[model samples]
Target: MPVSPRIGLVGSQGAYGRWLRRFFEQRMGLQVWGRDPVGDTALSERALLEEVDVLVFCAPIRQTPEVIRHYADIAAGIERGQLWLDITSIKAAPVAAMLSSQAEVVGLHPMSAAPKSATLRGRAMVVCEARLDAWRPWLEAFLAASEADCVRAEAEQHDRVMALVQGMVHASHMVQGAVLRELAPDVGGLDAIRPFASVGYELDMAVMRRMLASNPAIYQDIQFDNPHVAPMLERMSAQLDKLCDLVWRGDNVARDQLREQLLERSRDYAGKQSVAEGSYAFERLGYLLADLREPRFISVFLPLDRPGSLRALLSVFEQRGINLDSIHSSRSADGELLFRIGVSRDGDATALQDAVRAIEAEGIGRVLEASGIA
Candidate 1:
C-alpha cells in the first residue's frame, strides 16, 4: 500500500532507537532502515535522505542539533515534502535546526524512558508541530499507532516545562541517590534500609534505583544539556538551604516560616484538588507495592493462548485449596504473558509445592519461578 511509508531511524543502536526499530517494523509493519554510528550496517546520509519517506532523529540529545544541521545542509531542497521528526527530550534547538530544511518537522518527547511495552499506551508524549502541511495526516497516523497520550505545545514551552518536570525531578533523585550511596554502606547497604522504608521512601528509591540502573549519559544529559536546568537547580538549592536554616534555628518563628513556605504555599500553588489526586494516586501505588512485597508467590507461563489457559492455571490452586493473596499478570521481554499468583504462606507450604508440581505435570502451565520450591 502506498499509504505505508518506509521509516529511517537516524540513531538505530541507542535504546530508544532499537525500540523504535521494533515498533515501526513489527507494530506498524513498515520497513525501517537504521543508521547508527556504532551499530547497524552503515547507511549513507544520502541514501537515507533520498529513500525513506519519514526520517526520525533518535540521536542523543547533545548530538541531535548537529545531526539535523548536517542533514539540512546536504538535503539541498530534496527534503521538501518529507516528514522529519525528532524524539529529543529538549526540543527548541533540534526543532530549529530541522526547520532549516524544507521538510515538514515535528519534535516529540515521550515523557518516559524506552518502555517494555509494544506501544506507549499509558505514557504522555509532547508534540511540537513546527511544520506539518502535507504530512499532517501521515503524522497523525503514526501518533495514533504509538498509542501515546499526545499533548501539543510550542517547542520553547516544552523545553521550559521539561526543565521542571524532568530536570528538577531527576536532579532531586540524583541528590538522594548520592546520599544513599554514602549512607548505604554505613547502614550495611539497601537490604538493611529496606525494612524501615516508608511508602514514599520506597517509591522514591524505586525512581532512584531505576535511574542508577539505566545509561548514565541519559541522566547526565538531562541535567547538563537543558539550558533551563541551571536556574531551576539554583532555585531548588536556595529552598533546600532555607529548610536547613529553619531546622537549625529550631524556634517557633522558624517553624511557622517553614510551614508557610513548604506546606501552605506549596499546597496553595498546587491547588487542593491536584494535591488530593496525587495523594490518591500514591495510595494506589502503595497498595500495589504492599501486594508485591509478599515473597510467597509463583510466576507461571501459560503455553497456549486458548480460552481456558488461565482458568486451568487457577484450577490447580483452587483444587489444592491454596488460598491466594493476590493474582497479577505481566509480560516477559519477548511479550509472553506471565501470571504471578500469591498464596498464603501461613497455610500448608506443602500444598503450594503440590500445586507447582501439578501445574507442570498436568501441562496446565510452566512454573517460571516459585518461592520455597526447588
Candidate 2:
C-alpha cells in the first residue's frame, strides 16, 4: 500500500464494479485491473494478486465469500500488507473470509445503486474495518475521494442494519406488488389505477418498479445470502398477522389496540423529531409528484456544457412570455445531463411550441418530449 494503491476489481463488469472502476481511474487517478468470471477481464486471478496492491471483491453476494476464500488460499502470505475490500449488501461472511487472508481487510457497503456521478457525493457508505495497520492512511484517502458520508460499523452490526433497511423494506414492497397484481384486475390493471393513485402510492410504485427493472440476482442474493434476513421477515409476518386479527375484530377494543400498537407505540419508538422530519419530507415529495403529474412540461438536452447554454435556453421561453412552473435538472442513466421544465397550465400552448422550435433552431437545446399538450 503506497500513497496510491494499484486497484484490482474481482467483478469489474458489474454495475458497482464499473462505477468504482471509473471512480478509481478518473477521480483518484489510480491504475486498475479487473477479473470477472462472466466476461474476459484484463487480469487473471494470479495476475491481480501479483499486480494490484488493493483487491476489491465486487462480485455478487452469493459468490463473494468463496471468491475471497479462493484468492486468500492462492495468495497465501503473498498478499500480506496489501488491502482487501468488498462492496456487498451483506458484510459478515465476506469480511470473515477476508480476515482469514493475509491482506488488511475491510468491508464496504455503499447505500445506493451505482450512480451516474463519478463520486458517491451526498450518499452514505458503511465501512467495517476488520484489520488495518499500515493501510489506514490510504484507506482514509480513498474514502475521502469517494465523498460519501462514511459510517463505521462492525461487520455483524452492518448485516443486522441491512436486514432492516434493505431486506424488510424490499420484502414488504415485493408483497405489495403481489397484492396489486392479484387485485388490479378488479379495478382494471395498473394503468387505470395509477391515474387515481395518491402521492404515497405513486412513490411506492416508483421504488417497486425500480427493483423490478434491475438485475433479479442482486435482489435475490440480498434476501437469500444474508442470514439475518430470515428473522426480519418472520417479525414482519407476525406484525401483519396482528394487524389482520385486529381488523377482523372490528371493535372499540381492537381499534384501541391498533392505535396503541401501530401508531402510538411506534411513534414513541421512532421519537418526535424523526416523525416530524418524515412528515415534512412526505409533504415535499407530495408537491413534487403533483407538479410532475400535471404533465405540462418538456425535457431538453443541451449539446453544449458551457455556462451560457441554460440562460440562452431560458431566454427563448421568456421571449414568448411563457412562465415556467418548475424546472429540474438530472443526469440520465447513461450520464447525459437533461432538464425537465414544467409550463404553467394556463400558458399558451402555441407560444410554448414556438419556444421549443426557437431553442432548437438557435442550438440552445433540443426538446426531448412535450407531454400533456395537443
Which candidate should be chosen as best, given lDDT against the real structure?
A: 2
Q: Candidate 2, after superposition: displacement of residue 105 in Å?
A: 1.2
Residue-by-residue lDDT tens digits, candidate 1, 1-374: 13888898999999899999999989889999989888676778988888888899999899899999999898999888788999999999999999999888999999888888889998999999998887888788889999999999999999889999989999999999889898899988999989999999999999998898988888888889889999999999999999999999999999999999999999999999999999999999998898889888999988887998888889888898888899988887676689988888786888888888999999888888898543
How does model 1 score by TM-score? 0.94
lDDT to native, each model: 0.90, 0.91
The TM-score values for the models, in the order shown, are 0.94, 0.95
Expressed as tens digits, the lDDT of each residue in 215-243 for candidate 2 is 88988999998899999999999999999
Residue 201 in candidate 1, Cα distance off native in Å: 1.4
| Cα lDDT, model 1, residue 234 | 97
Clashes of each: 0, 0
TM-score of 2: 0.95
